[model samples]
Target: MDKQIETELEAAAFRGLLTHLQNHPEVQNIELMILADFCRNCLAKWYAEAAKERGIDIDYEQARDKVYGMPYAEWKDKYQLTATPEQMAAYEKRQKEKQ
Candidate 1:
């Protein structure tokens, strides 16, 4: 595939992922981290890094807003659930495994 076509395809895939995440608020960030070693926050950080690489001055919060489809605080208030003890333990285990 041409470079432009490949880029467009990747962009479309990213958009589809974002839409899926937005539609599934119950899939908490911690859960994503536990399952995939990354989460929406990771995505936001990557987004910000990419913008920086492109000479665009997008900050973390701005990237987060784009990924969350709203302000992070508002999204947290609306849908983010507190991690349970089990989840925390699992997360810790995952962290250790990463080391």
Candidate 2:
């Protein structure tokens, strides 16, 4: 594919993934980290980095909003739950295994 077409396809795939994630807030970030090695916060960091690379002025909260489909605080208040000790332990084990 041409470079522009490739970029557009890539952007579309990203948007689809973002939309899926937005619709599935029940999927906890820690679960994503344990399973996929990254989560919405990782996406936000990458988004901020990409914006910086492109000389765009996007901060972490803006990037997070893009990923969360709302302000981070609102999302946190609504959907984010405290991880149980067992969940945290499993995530830590997964991270160690990855390393």
For candidate 1, the lDDT comes to 0.97
Q: List the residue pairs that clash in candidate 2.
A: none
TM-score between candidate 1 and the true structure = 0.98
Which candidate ranks first by lDDT, i.e. highest? 1
TM-scores for all predictions? 0.98, 0.96
Per-residue lDDT for 33-88 in model 2, tens only? Answer: 87898999999999999999999999999999999999999999999999989889
RMSD of 2: 0.8
Error of 2 at 21 (Å): 0.4
Error of 2 at 95 (Å): 1.9
Q: Candidate 1 clash total? A: 0
Candidate 1 lDDT over 1-99, as tens digits, reads 999999999999999999999999999999999999999999999999999999999999999999999999999999999999999999999999999
